[model samples]
Target chain A: MAVLERSYKRYAGALSPEWSRFLIIPRHAFRDVFRSKLFTGLYALSFMAPLVFAILIYLRHNTEALAIMKLSVVNVLPIDATFFLTFVEIQGWVGFFLALLVGPQQVARDLTNNGLPLYLCRPFSRSEYVVGKMSIVILLLSSITWVPGLILFGLQSYLEGWSWFSQNIPIASAIFLGSLVWILLLALLTQTISAWVKWRLAASAGLIGLFFIPSVFAAILNQMLATRWGNLLSLGSLIRSVWAGLFGTFVQQAGQVQRMRGGVIVETAMVEPPLWASWLILFLICALCLWLLSRKVKAYEVVK
Target chain B: MTLDAPATSSHLNDSPGVITLDNLSVTFGGRPILKSLNGDLRGRAIGLLGPNGAGKTTLIHTLLGFHQPSAGTARILGSDIRGEANQIKSLIGYMPERDSFISKMSCIHFVRFMAELSGLPPGAALERAHEALFFVGLGEARYRNVDTFSLGMKQLAKLAQAIVHGPRLIFLDEPTNGLDPPARSRMIKMIREIRDSGQANIVLSSHLLRDVEECCEEIVILKDGRLVVYCNLEEERKANKKFLMLETRGDLKSFVEGIGSLGCECAMTSDHRLKIILQDGTEIRDLYKLAAASQVQIRRLTYKRDSLEDIFLKAMENGSN
Candidate 1:
């Protein structure tokens, strides 16, 4: 229709399926997200770690490069569980920073601007709206985390042959599963804060405080009470414990601590919280975030 | 541009009533907001009117499925709001009263986003978004961010998004709120045009009785959470046709006697002014003929039909009783 005619016309076109309608949120959200130069820069920078990991995997297989560097294949960082574990840890932190940059404004913008009714008044539900906003962080973090982590694993599997791939399948599982857990946690936590805080800067600070402040309190508690149970209060410690377990390094990392007492060296095994406790704490935190999210994300507020 | 034939959705039932409230009630924290509102609103443009705190907005919210009805249910386009809210929502468009827009989105993009959420395919949504913007007279500023638009522009943008997807029913909550006179007239004109187009049913909730009186064929007036009045505006106006006011010269006694002989009730408010309540089967022509025959010149004549304000005020009085 020409702009001059200025007549309202009926749209008789076909509609998208109900199930896939939620994808529209992320589709539009991605456009707004990439419009930010800072976010775009950070998102582009996120791939550097994956690119560097791929180079490390390539160098481990290139005997010419290893010899030129005066290093043997054995002396180079082995493409093993620890190697992938370190890769996941670095990518996980990168994903956190990426989410921190983007996630705080996802739900907060809608609530602050009175946009929820526009969404809810459509065929969309509250859960779909939440999932749609959550998908922004989920998709972005997945690309930087497990998606590339698995690609790196596939590269090693292709280069090192079937025997190496068959023997070290757990490392691949750990990279995928561990990154998934962290991504879900970050997505839910950041959205929860966004919904509650409703201010972008304050929400960013809340996300940082949610993770770091608890760890500080946990450290103080552990020192004062002499208990490993304080790890339950620290989300970072709980997630680290879970990641360590997933990578098969929990036992090794918790094996021994050597300290000097009375001018003598005494080696003692450090006590650690049960891996199940960490898993339980993370699950409870995620559940709490979801409950809090459900409470705040509404189209109308009821006043009495 | 040529207009397509009005599209009808397969999901919509061919019911006469656009919205049917079946004893619907809503309470917020034990305080009733809507108390058993029951009516079948079937007009092309239904006006919802009430004083402040009379539950006008709450009724719209309940029908939109924003607030679940505490007692009974309402049907929008033949779908039950309780069981088929999603289906009802798919067939309806809503223009909220408050300022609602994505903070940084352009007018076209915001309307397109709303269209997509309403179930239009992405390409169709973008196309219709442009058409809707143009229709609302925002074509020149479609590229501007909605937040940067003036209040009038924002109201038009909200309207553009509401009608973009060709919904079967639309809920317009205070659509003319905060608009200046020209903008308000433009909004009212567009609303009447939409009503005349026969493409969608409108539920216009507003505090301004003039806005409602101008655009609506049927009205539902609420008072203190109760359905005080529900009637067709044309029928209400027609019912008040018996009352008339007249200014006259010459022999008024003969004219009064002639009016009384026609079974009309006439009261002499002053020497030259008369208030006549015409009886059934009496027409204004009969009075004019009687005045001519009685040698009384009918100087001025006015039919005193009840305005919407009168109807609203009367309803409020009766609701209080």
Candidate 2:
């Protein structure tokens, strides 16, 4: 009873007017995803990928001996941190996929399933629906990417050593915040696409195409036109790689920050944009997408 | 997008009705689905009749607060639907046209879940769901999976959810959509029972004219998003042409000449038969004396009264043509 009451207070105190509506959607959205055969496959793969990676590490330890295994990763040419960036990669793919799945369908469900009229007839306003949509996307992103990634990260970090995490945790905090920004951006991007499209598969393809179109244009320029401008404009890969590059170097050495630019393959860091700008664009796009999404959902007719 | 003025705000008013649409319109992708429509219905059973795409469900949505009008306002009870939707929903029982429950869930569980969604406690939701299933005549099949239910039973389960909250107003949209004739009749009878028992006000929408004519005390008909007809069973009949029909034995030519001169219509039913229909203001004494003088026996005299169905059909046809 105390456990129940204790959790209730904690949950209730975290409430905002918007949060109240969102409370069930996160849990519900997760349930929805698990119910889908395709999503369940993706979910299983997510859990399986890390397990495979963990097994590889375990096998490497057994074959090389635990002491030598630690030496190879922790000491030899290991960037001095033994920083495994697998979780970041997983978060990126999972977050993008989940956002793409839920975004358009949530919008399209109102339009296609003819639930918009019925959903509207409930105690929610049009704007409230918009809020609910965004909140659900955010929750789903966290569920599909951040939370799972963090859990795995925690497990690996604990297995690695308490000292490694205790020393590197601040950088870990920064990485977590950065992951949040990436998730928010992905969510808003999908929502913006869903605003115009009613079907999930089409909206998802459109979203993917939007990201790759930039890449295709970049590839044409980089390979065909011989310009690096193509590389800069590949926003999808840039979004994934840049955030991964930033977060993967968690708990950076203070001296390294002064001596070397982090995670750059091209040696000179002249091409990379500032992280603050990335954050601003993400938030700005979120606000803009929400405004447009509200209009789309509001314009949907529930004439049955 | 929210109106601050209480008088103008259609969402917050507390009027006594299960459902009400004052003035509501819904547009989809720049196409107007519903226009300025108003209906004031106080009967236990009120039918909303219209052709396909005539905004029956749209009006239901507006009454439910799923769609707010662009121009006019709507109110459920005294609260404006735009302002106090939660309050209105708490009292409204809505059975939407589409399938709503998760397919994997059993009928009993789905009803309980929806009841809980409406703010009922778990135990209370269960109790109410059970009672509602029983009331909707789904007692034995309540425990079966919703996927196993026939279309009629699934529809009944949806109906069960709507009433579980004990809302004052209930909206049943195409409740008998896929039902066979007998099932359809049973559904209609259930609606009548729900209303006649005075448990709640029902606004049932269907294209079935017979259902409306039999079950409803009043009907609001919509055509192309516009209200084409609103008939109070008693008032509509009263306003229609009421006249005495007389069966007379005479040559149609003589009866026609005499009745035409008297400003009456002599309808010739057969070779030797004529029906002299008396207009409201016609002097009955004159007709009797004329009949006596002509040696026409008044074989039959009866007042011709129109049924509600006739009024509904005429209104729709007039609106269309």
Candidate 3:
């Protein structure tokens, strides 16, 4: 019998460069995130802080509006280092919640369904898969955190003029670097937890517990050991320390941190760990998450 | 069923098979799965026939660079499996036995995603995804979510993603699994079309002999992790001595004598069933004329050739010995 002629033709076009292949994972991930109305709402809400901060910068610089409102800059909100610090801190925390919403479902579903083989069977390696999944969280967190934080910083600099911008250049740098560190930590931690825990809800809960559970244990250690070294276990304390260090406000903000926790106004005996220790601890944690991710993401699981 | 001599050559460098194994062995926790398997297969559509636990999937995985060999190595398309894994994967497509798709995606989206992962540009990937879905008979439901597809549809979607990149070699592990008769027939037809297109070489692994028999040009039968038979179906058919079965309602002794005189081997296993091996000069027409002359009624006549099942059963028997 004569063979049936197929209309299908081979693809003769050039492939995209190899480096751009990993972008496919994040591209689809962004689409999936935006597909959900709730995720879209949360993502939009994350920009609110930067938007409000931008408006505040505008109001502080516009003397006519301030005069119309009959409010002085000091009487309203003083736009200074602490103001931008608070801005970045708020944005970073919002990024954390965003990670909790989207991170657990990113790689967990793929791992649970044994879909790594599909990815690895192509031209992609295991490291590419990990970086691809990480990009989803990195892009999500970046949109709300450093990206807008820097935009607001630019707005503040534009409104306040070059003299003020030059004097406070370090503050802008702090906002960018501080928010970047926060998002990186959150992205790695959430992705690692998600990769290990197959269920989305359990992985989400595990990510939350990873941040909070250590603080409780750290508190017990602090009470027993009479040292602030235990605070190293608390992600909140470590991040705050890192943030303060980035802004060069740790010495001035330590008392406020203690007071905000409702501790007595007297001098506390617990000496906070050095800033280097905080940075070291965060780096180690990031490394550990990467190791765990590498262990879990593979084409096939060999069972002995 | 006659068994051919075992493939005793360590490696066949003279003939470059589509895939070559040189003492390839794999183990899990010191327990061997595939033990020093060596063969060269050049069939356009090769069938991997094995029972459960016969290491069919493992062999496919090894060839795809999923499993690192414990001892020797394998080369696919002149590229070593270990070092050139990404290079090899870029040129090949794989459809695993189990459910291995991202279900949350639409069929076209998933196929496009897979094609992009195989290194096609996004635009070309999208176009090829549509073409592959239509080729696999899933164009109508291309917009449907993959998770919502029926078992047969899901299988076709798997096939679509596998071929979306226009790969040079495609590995299909149980491609017709879990389908009804019509779906199975459609799958076999698709496989035949793919084979006929000359666009890619297909390695179809199946436990069902009919599926392999219908689509494969050559076969490799494995039993207990050993290569029991590696023979081309075309050669096997040509090598077969023609046999004929006759059911007559008259004296069989005279019929056997008549057939023997015609230079054919004749045997009578029962009163009414006669088996005859035809010689080169003898034909069925001559037998009918002989039967008419001998006053015998020819009720049935069947011509037989060697089948994949016969080779598989013979390979199993030889492996046990």
Going through the candidates in order, their DockQ values are: 0.66, 0.09, 0.36
Report every candidate's CA lDDT: 0.88, 0.64, 0.85
Q: What are the TM-scores, per candidate, against the unseen true structure?
A: 0.92, 0.67, 0.88
Residues B110-194 of candidate 3 have per-residue lDDT tens digits of: 9999999988988888988888888888878999999898889989999998888888889999999999999999999989988
In model 1, which regions exceed 4 Å deviation?
A2-4, A252-268, B1-16, B251-290
Best by lDDT: 1
Give the DockQ-based CAPRI class for model 3.
acceptable
- Model 3 Cα lDDT, one tens digit per residue, A12-59: 679888988888999988888888898899988888888888878888
Off by over 4 Å in 3: A1-9, A76-78, A163-168, A252-268, B1-16, B241-304
Could you tell me the lDDT of residue A39 within candidate 2? 71
Q: Can you rank all candidates by lDDT, best first?
A: 1, 3, 2
Error of 1 at A299 (Å): 0.5
Better-scoring candidate (lDDT), 2 or 3: 3
For every model in order, the TM-score on chain A comes to: 0.92, 0.68, 0.90
Q: Give the per-residue lDDT of model 2 (tens digit) for B145-242.
A: 88788888988888887777666778888888898998888778878877776767788898888877777877888888888777676555553334
Give one digit per residue, the lDDT tens place, for model 1 in A1-304. Answer: 4556666556677889999988999999999989999999999999998999999999999999988889887877888888888889999998899999999999999998899999999999999999999999999999999999999999999999999999989988999899999999999999999999988999999999988999999989866665567888998888888888999988623566566779998876656789998898889989999999999999988876
